[model samples]
Target chain A: MAFAVHRPESMEAVIAALDGTASVAVSGGTLAIRAINEGKSFPLAIVSLRRAGLAGIAQDDGMIEIGAATPIAELVRPDLAFLDGVIASFGAPAVRNMATLGGNLFAPQPYGDFGVALLALDASLAIAGPSGKRRLPLSKFYETGLASNEIVTGIRFAPPAPGTWRWLKATRRALNSAAVIAVAAIIETDRSGTISAVRIALGGVDSHPVRSPVAEAGLLGQVLDSASATKAGEAAATFHPCFTDTYASAWYRRRVLPVFMRRALLGTPLETMP
Target chain B: MKSSYVSFTLNGEEKELLIEPGRRLVDVLREQCGATGTKNGCGQGSCGACTVHIDGVAMLSCLLPAELVDGSEIVTIEGVVRNRVLHVLQEAFLAQAATQCGFCTAGMIMAAKALLDCDPSPSRQAVIEALSGNVCRCTGYEPIIAAVLAAAATLAKRPAAAAAA
Candidate 1:
């Protein structure tokens, strides 16, 4: 049986096409294409986002606006150095060329490094749905899930201050491996070196990426150092329960979450304790 | 649903064909186009044996959808050879024994071609990063990496050779 493909040229066309029976939106197609090929159930029509006028990077007034359908490979600009590093470690070169940022947000757990990074960046998403257009913080979007007829149009975030954003992914290999423990954060200190603000996100340890509220609370108003980072890391582990899988055991992930958390915040090596 | 017509440039020549929706690019290249040079190491996107150049970027043909190829330029392993002569990277692989079972050579050459086309002189880490999508069971990666570097040097000195590639 042949599947119908709808190539829409604008956001309105995409939103209208999505209203068709059993139609779904497809951007980049790295995951959706594979899922269809693997004999998973097919939608009657696919609304391709490639032609939907949603593939560019722009910055205005310190806010970076990225078209949701923009390929991860195109995000290697000098201003996005940390994102470049994250993309390099996200997948192979071929994968990077095809995977889209919007698709990454909806990707299954353990496969969305970009999602984790965006969550920590406190990014907001502009989504177009059957009702109308609306904005949602990445955290709320993840919590509430997307409506079947909604399509993410863009992601907006301000670049974090220099040296304020820290990220680390402990993987099975140096490149393109699934994370054993992935962490990203924006941590700030006051003039006296006390932790003033923190936003931490974790991946690979749960069914979905999550912000570590316990860690943030633990680190607030405390001195930013190895000891405090270790304490916050331990608290972060309590925020989520790990599960056993092919990549790692639940016990192992739980035991190492603190180590990765510390390393993400304090720049400590994985094997060494603070 | 009906099969859609896809017209794209293949190896510098415009080719038109009708393919069913959801048909993978690798299948069309191998079955319909008779371009078996692009092998399918893993039908999933894991192995790079089916790598091809889509719009001057290296991508896994196995992961590409047939409906997405309209108006794009695609080059498989068959396109890598010019004027009945092997490309520099192919010659380097031959001299360095970069192939073991030879299942991955076409994809490796295509990937190397994409990398060199963009950055003629890539560092060792860059070469490794470029080929990270491809996996080979034989010859280890040392010879393949070395072969890519050697081909880069060959292209550096001979501008015509680089132009032909």
Candidate 2:
């Protein structure tokens, strides 16, 4: 089937293009185009964000704002070194060049590892629709996906404190493989090294990435160590359901969830882990 | 659906073509432009056999719509050669026997070329990381990694030769 591609230059035009038609936004084309090549049914139209004025990174008042269409490759700058490991855990360099931050937020499980990290960081999304622009928390946006006429304009989040951010993705291959189980966490501690605040997000364990509130609650008032991490891991894995895919089995993922959660919380080196 | 016109620089040459709706860049390059060097292995983003440079950044051509390259600079395996001379990376690949079946050679070279263009002397780990997307089932990847490292070393010693290529 022939489908029209609309390369709109502005956010207003993009929303207008999606106002009524069954159109999908194309950012980097990593996901949308792949679906097309796989012989899946194409949308009525494609709204290309390549030329839209929505690709950039800006820092203001300790918050980092990244345009929704910005390539994942651009996130590897030295100034954003804290995200180095998280971004690297994504696809290889070529794929990274074509994947966008906003697209990752919508990617299915075992693929949206970056989105999991953002969830742990409490990131918010800037969405623009026909009505106007609106701010929504990333977690909430995941629950209620984009309206037909809305497009994600940008993502904003404050930088995590040094030595507090941790991310890990367990893959069958060291590179280019989908995650067997992915974990991202932000653990803040008091001056005495007692846990103050914590947010943990897990991917490859559900249909979408989910926060481990039980894990976070268990870690509070406790020191971050192997024992506490183990407890937190157990708490997080208690009743969660994991799905199986070509990369791993549901049984295997359930068995490894707690182990990976502990490893992620303890900041264990990937090379040293199973 | 109506056909659309796309104009872009292909390997230093300006070309324009009327592409059908929903056509991808890889198909256009191989069929319309006669640049068959960019192989369409999987026709999906999973395989890097269709890797090409758009605006000096490496990307999978199969995933890029023809309209997206309307005003961009594109470089394929056919463009890697300058004045009938193979690029240093090509030479190193030949010297190191990086190609067995040779199907993935073009994409591998293109991906490696972009890595070297950005970093003149990339470490072994970085070379492996850069070429990770381009899969080589026949050679087992060690020789390809060696060729890239060797090319980086050669490029480091002779800056003039590297620049000329």
> Could you tell me how far off, in angstroms, the CA of residue B90 lies in candidate 1 after the best superposition?
0.7
- lDDT (Cα, 0-100) at B73 in candidate 2: 98
TM-score of chain B of 1: 0.96
What are the models' TM-scores? 0.96, 0.97
**CA-based DockQ, model 2:** 0.79
Candidate 2's displacement at residue A156, Å, is 0.9
lDDT value, residue B3 of candidate 2: 85
> Model 2 residue B65 lDDT?
86
* lDDT string, candidate 1, A1-274, tens digits: 2368888899999999989588768888778877776767477887789999999999999999999999999999898986766887888888888889998998887788888899899999999998999999999988898887899999999999998888898787787787788899999999999999999998876777888899899999999987888788888776688777777887887788888788789866646744
Candidate 2, residues A94-142, lDDT tens digits: the string is 8999999998888888898878989998999999998899999999988
